[model samples]
Target: MENIKFIDQNLEKGLYLVSTPIGNLADITIRALNILKKSDIILCEDKRVSKKLLDYYDIKVQLFSYHKFNEKESVEKILEIFKKNKIVSLISDAGTPLISDPGKILINEIEKNNIKIISIPGPSAVTAAFSLAGYSDDYYFYGFLPKKLGERKKVYEQFSNLESSIIIFLPARDLVSIIKEMKEFLGDRQITIAKEITKIHENIIKGNLDNILDKIKTVVLKGEVTIVLSSEANKNKDQNIDINKEILDLSKKMKTADLAKYLAKKFKFSKKEIYQKILIFNKK
Candidate 1:
């Protein structure tokens, strides 16, 4: 490996938002490494997690614990470090800082005090998964879903009607239940699951919601997961039919099963979906 020289003069006295690798340590940028090497202090979610990366390149610096639990308390101390004209760098356990990570409070304070802040961009799981998912160019990142079932359901409902692709982070344990709930509220749209991104176990599973739910049930997943849901717009345009109105008018004469069969043949959607819609429409 070539020795990359660190130029201390290039970095200014300010708080640097450094983006670390999402999974593969080598995925980090040269500029990010340089910033970390030159920083006076490094603020991170977990010192143990950050230490591994720092140890890899032999970049020794003070690692301060700065996470959601202590964000408010850490802000004043960080500002104090700034007063001494020290170069501080804030990093998350993985990926970019403040993108579902801590740092917003400190950033707001830095701006209020007129302190300089710089961003050193690098690898991000959100963009990585989005790029590989092969969904629409436009997307809405919904970060992590709420732990509570009711709140999670509300979130699904909120984005159920959205036209663009949806990106969400999920823990390995909650993957099965969450996918089941998604099918219930979001319908059977296409989905892509990016697991353990950039690592040896990295896997991308793509299929319709119904098929994905079945596939996921057989396998056990670990590490971080990023899910990309294809746009409702794409499904709508592909079918190009007002399913509600069609079900209402057709049900006036035909039985539920017969109507479902008729619509299933005429459209791209599944018979099970049409049957459910017919039942729901008639009950209303």
Candidate 2:
């Protein structure tokens, strides 16, 4: 396609940061193919995955492991090649390198060594998830979810009251438990689960956490999941909510505290936090 123009134009210079498909191999871009075809070498998270993709396109460019474990070690060898004025492309197992993947160290090394860098940006699971899930662009990406519970809480506290979407990558095995935890901790905040994207089983489920958890249990999900959650909607409730008016409105049919709790849940805040703020704000 016309997207290959930039690659041909700059084929002679720089460290090419190539992006590959997250799932479907057909998703690879022409410019990325051109860079890989002309590259001096490729650094990959896994040699086998890169080899398979390279084999599909019949690209004979050499590839070597440059993931987290051996990234530091590869830096010297990579810099040595850069000295020869040869361009290299860095790729990961899936998606773009250094985007919640490896090759970050190598990129840093290339820049530090003053090797010019050019990017062949393409398919990214993060952006794909957002597009397929209809997620708001105003968001924060955790890159990947924390496996540890304590770390999760500390992370949750940082974004608990913010007003933007939260996106996280999770493996299939941990999806259920993580979804359950979010529901229990964050209330009925809207969440979208995009699974097996671009594959035969590709699916997207958007709804409250509790309902989404039930749906997953019914189906045997077999791949990575992209989680997106809507942030607080009616932000600045105390300042903007018109406390007396809201209390009067909902109180006509529901208890004041209960209605406050319900409204708080809708915004992904805890009932205690909302009620306490309401108590103080009303007093003031």
Candidate 3:
């Protein structure tokens, strides 16, 4: 065992974005423990969830709830603490703060006020999933697919044709439906599903979209999930396709928004870009 030094006085007056473990409590760094132990107040998404981690490590710091609903109300009150040169730390219920989590608004205010902000980085699901997936040299990450059907379609469409692997964080419950939908848009592309990463029952499942869908039906999946999608191998290569002609043909049958969204997902271009092109073609 190694002796770890816990720094308290060096914890300067500012906002500390501490990264907590996604599943395993031992994944947390010694520095993060020090900051959490010494900070005047720890702003967390949920006090109940955060308490489990705090109690696990014997950290008795003051905890406060600052989730999305109360975030607008808490900004100024937190800034006032910063003005008094008090050390404040912000953490999500799991993983790092502001990664598909609240704290962006608070961070903006902190920077605007010119108060210092420190990052005590540690475990994150994105990197964890990517490392385990081993699909590509590079990848695109979409944290939590959109809830609305149209928006979700657009998200799947946007990444459908990407050469790089797509990493996403989604609920385990929606796994079956999401895969069925992805199969429609993305075909039987290979994917790796990392469930409850770093925890005791952590399971990583890998197969094409079709097979994994069947496999998941055998068991009930609980807790959070991270998915990594391998790039399409042979079909829908963008370079050989005619964007203008596809747009022209689809425009005849589809609404402008729908066509833009459809083609946006089919090609590498964005919806806004495709929409503008369709508008220009309409002018002719």
Candidate 4:
């Protein structure tokens, strides 16, 4: 499907997993807009919240509240409509459905009933943050942080070891605490915190846990935050290198200690290891 092109054709009369903008109003794709506009009935997290977007675009389709708390009932209500052969569209307050949201139940129900699910993808904060992070793209998506510290630590450790970039959705109130905990669990890990995505005051703060704390010290951090962290091993920095080449260059006129220091600075390693390598190379 082309970007910014509206879907003008007839869609199957079941469920449409429509993606909305994570941040930046313009991020919404034409396909998503087309689906939202053409849907017979729209299921949203909040009627008022979704209405703002719908009304802004002059969408007058039927809107209803369908969220985790009311999902069981909503499912039955939705099924009633589906039986009538009406096409239903599901959207979250922001971003794609089922990412820290409860739009998946309807999708599962539709699948179980042997109905089809049409997907019209749109912008995601996870994607937005990663693109601007200036970090490696290989990553995983964790919808949200665990409520308990132990559980969160377990999750954090796993990501830290893999050294893969991670995207986490966090409540505004818990943002500072979560960042602080991340600092303790993982040392010197880089993070990019994006807040109020797409809307004004959209901020992407990039730094280590401690550095970010300092940055947000005087500022009032409102709105939800999507935390994007660099992998445990940052590839942009000189962590991985050819030790053979390192030794070859060190053997030429530089003392082991000096060479080790130089290599250590370039590649995030201790000087002692490089120094020993130099001695071993010098002996040969």
For every candidate, C-alpha RMSD to the true structure in Å: 4.2, 4.6, 6.1, 7.1
Q: Model 2 compared with the native: what TM-score? A: 0.83
Q: lDDT tens digits, residues 162-259, model 1?
A: 78999999887888888877876666788999888888777888888778877776557766689999987768653545777788677988988888
Candidate 4 TM-score to native: 0.79
Residue-by-residue lDDT tens digits, candidate 3, 1-284: 12556765666788899999999888999889999989889999999999999888777888888999999999989988787888899999889899999998999988999998999999899999999988878989889998998999888778865789999988888888888888766666678999988998888898877678777776567767999988854334453258788876777899999998887667644466578779988998
Question: Clash pairs of candidate 1?
Answer: none
Model 3: weakest 10-residue lDDT segment is 232-241
TM-score comparison, 1 vs 2, better candidate: 1
Model 4 agreement with the true structure over 1-284: per-residue lDDT tens digits: 23345557987787888888765666777778888888999999888788777776667899878989998877878888888999889899888888788976777787888877887888778888778787766888887888998899788667655657888888878888987777655555678888776777777788876578888776566667888887756733443447657778657877667777777656534455456667877788
lDDT per prediction?
A: 0.84, 0.75, 0.84, 0.76
List TM-scores for all candidates, in order: 0.86, 0.83, 0.80, 0.79
Candidate 2 lDDT (Cα, whole model)? 0.75
> Candidate 3, 264: how far from true, in Å?
18
Q: Which candidate gets the maximum lDDT versus the true structure? A: 1
lDDT of 3 at 155: 86
Give candidate 2's error at residue 206 in angstroms: 1.9
Worst 10 residues of 4 by lDDT: 235-244
lDDT of 1: 0.84
Q: Give lDDT: candidate 2, residue 99.
A: 81
